[model samples]
Target: MGKPDAEGHGPAEGLPGLPPEWGRVVVPDDASALAVEATQIRRELRRAGSLPGGHQALGLPLVVLLVAVLTTLAGLLAVTWPRANRGADRPTPAPWSPPATLVGRALPALDLVDADDAPVPLRGLLPAMIILLDGCPCPDRVGDALAAAPSGVSVVTVTGGRTPSARPTIERQARALADPAGGLRSFLGQPARPGAATALLVDRAGLVTRVLPELGTSDTYRNDLSVLAG
Candidate 1:
C-alpha cells in the first residue's frame, strides 16, 4: 500500500495477495489456537458417541421391564399349580347304605350277655351260626331252625331285649343270648324292623361268609341253613 512494508508486503490484512515466502512467518499463538479447536471437535464427537438416542435409549428399559414381568408371572404360576392339581387329583368317597350286606366282610366285635348274665364273646364263637331274631318269645320256626341246623355248626340265638321266661325255652333249642344294649343292631349295621330274621354264617377266621334274610316259611329257613352248612 505505502511502498509495502520493510519486506515489500502491504498490511497483514491483505494476506490473500501476499507472496508465498512473505506469508511464511511462524506464530506460536496460531498453533495453540488450532490445538484448542481440535480439542473442541474431539469433545463434540465423543459426546455424540456416548449419548444413546431414539429406539436404543428406549430398548434398555423395555428389556428390563419384560424380564420383571416374566419373573412375576412365573412366580404366580408356581404357587397356584400344586393346589389346582391337588383338587383335580382327589377322589369322592362312595355313599353308605344301611343293612349293607356284611357277607365277605370281617365281623365286628360283639360282646353280649346270655340269659344267665354270663358274657358271651361272639368273636370267640367262630365257625358258628348266629340267628338274630326280634324280641323274645323266640318264634317257633326260628327255634326249630336253630335246632335243625346241620352238625359241626354251633347255633346261638340273639334277642334284642331281656326275656327271663323266653330264655329257658330258647336255651332248650339253642344257646340263648340277650343284647340288652341293642348292640347287635349296631354291629349288623341295620335298623331293627319287626319280624325280620337275619342269620349270619361266620367262618373259622371270624369273617362272615354269608348273610341270610328270611321273611318266608320254615322251609326257606331250612334251605338257607343247609346252604350255610356246606
Candidate 2:
C-alpha cells in the first residue's frame, strides 16, 4: 500500500513495487511502446553515466549491418555499370535487303553451247557473271557493257529462246552462248521481257546471290558488277 497520487490512484496500482515519487513514469502496454520506453531509459542512463557511450551501446551488430548494405550496393553498381557503358558504345549491324525472285536459290545445270559450238558446263563456270539477253545477235550496247565488267568475274552472255549464231563482232567482247530450248528463261523462274536483260550474280558455290531484273544501262551494269565483285 503506497500513498495516493495526484490522480487519486495509488503509485503501486499500475506500476507495482515502484515508489510513490516514480508514479509519473508510465507503464507501457504494448511491445512498440515498451521499445520506445527502453530507448528513452538508455538515453537517460547514458547521460547519467550509468551506461556506456552511444557508439559503444550500438556495438558490432550495427557496424556489420551498415557494412553489408554498403557492400551490396557497391556490388550491384559494379555489375550494371559496364553493361550500361557497353550498350552505349556498341554499334548496330546493317540490315540485309530481302532476296528478290531467283536470288538465294541454287543455280541448276543447263545444257549450254559457246560461240565455238562446244559444250559448256554451267557448274564448271562457277562464280561467273551469266547475263541473259532476249535475241541471237548480241546487241552492240550490251556487248560494250559486258566489256566493262569487273575483273575476276567471267561474263557469259546467253541468248534466251534463240539458236546460236555467228556474232563475230561481239565474240571478241564476251563469250556468247545460245539457249535454243528456252531452258535459261525457265531456269530464271520467269520469262524474259522483250529487250530486257537479266544478270545473275553467281558465287563460287554456283549459288545466285542477286538477280538484277531489267538492268537499266551500261553504267548501272558496270556499277552493279563492281559491287558484286567487291
Candidate 3:
C-alpha cells in the first residue's frame, strides 16, 4: 500500500526506523559520562600545549634536584671510601716543669716548737715555710687556711706576742714557732699595719723565695707546696 516495500530487496526504508541489530545494542549511561570526560581531557591537553614551552614549571626543578643529589652522593662516596680504608694519628703535649731555682734546692734550717711542747725542726724534717703574722686580723686569716697544713707541710706560725699569756697561747695553738720574738709592739715596730701577715714561702733550701702579703689565697699555697713536693 505504501510504495510496494522494496521490490523484494528490502522493507521500503530498510525496515521502518532502526535495524534489529541497532535495537538490540543498548548504550549505557556510563558511555555518555566517558565521552564527556574524554572531551574535557582533550580540551585540557590542548590548553597545556598552548602554554609558552608546553612544559610545567615544576618539572625542571625536580630534574635539577635529582641530578644535584646524585652528584653529591657520588662525590661523598669517592672521597669517603679512601679515608675509611686509611687511618689517622694524634700527638700529645709536653709535660709541665717548675721554676729553675726551686727544683733540686736544699731545705731551709728553720728550728721551731709545736703545741705538744715538742721541738719541731722544720727544714730538717720536711720542705717548710714560715707564716709570720702581726697578731691581729692577719693571724685570724692565716689560722683558718693552715688549719689543715700540719699534716701536709710544716706550718710555723710566728706572731708578735705582747703579753705572757698571749705568747703561750700562740705557741700552744700554732703548729710550730721559729723564734717567738717577744711583744707585738716590739716585733711589728709599735703600731702594726693591716697586712703584716708576711708569709715566707721557703723551699727545701734555707732561702726564703716568695714572701706572701695575705693568706686568703689558700689554693695557691697548696699548689706551690704540691709542685715543690712533686
Q: Which regions in candidate 2 have their CA more than 4 angstroms from the true location?
A: 1-99, 135-138, 165-172
lDDT for each candidate structure: 0.59, 0.60, 0.46
lDDT of 3 by residue, 1-230 (tens): 11222123321222233335433222222223335545755665577678876558445644544444344344334333443323345456554322345424444343445444455566664445556555444556555545535344555566443211123233335444534543312322233346546555555545545545445666667666554444
TM-score of 1: 0.47
Candidate 1 vs candidate 3: which has greater TM-score?
Answer: 1
TM-score for predicted model 3 compared with the true structure: 0.36
Ranking of all candidate structures by their TM-score, best first: 2, 1, 3
Per-residue alpha-carbon lDDT of candidate 1 for residues 160-182, written as tens digits (9 for 90 to 100): 77741243344445666778787
lDDT of 2 by residue, 1-230 (tens): 32334334533224334345433333222224345545765665566565457566666535544443344344334333433344777788754322475777888888788767677877676666777777223466556655676776677778843455434444455667887777767777666666667777787677787776665556665665676566
The TM-scores, one per candidate, come to 0.47, 0.48, 0.36
Local lDDT at 30 for model 2? 26
User: Which 10-residue window in model 1 sums to the lowest lDDT?
Assistant: 24-33
Highest-scoring model, lDDT: 2
Q: Which lDDT value does model 1 have at 124?
A: 76
Cα displacement (angstroms), candidate 2, residue 202, comes to 1.6
lDDT of 2 at 116: 70
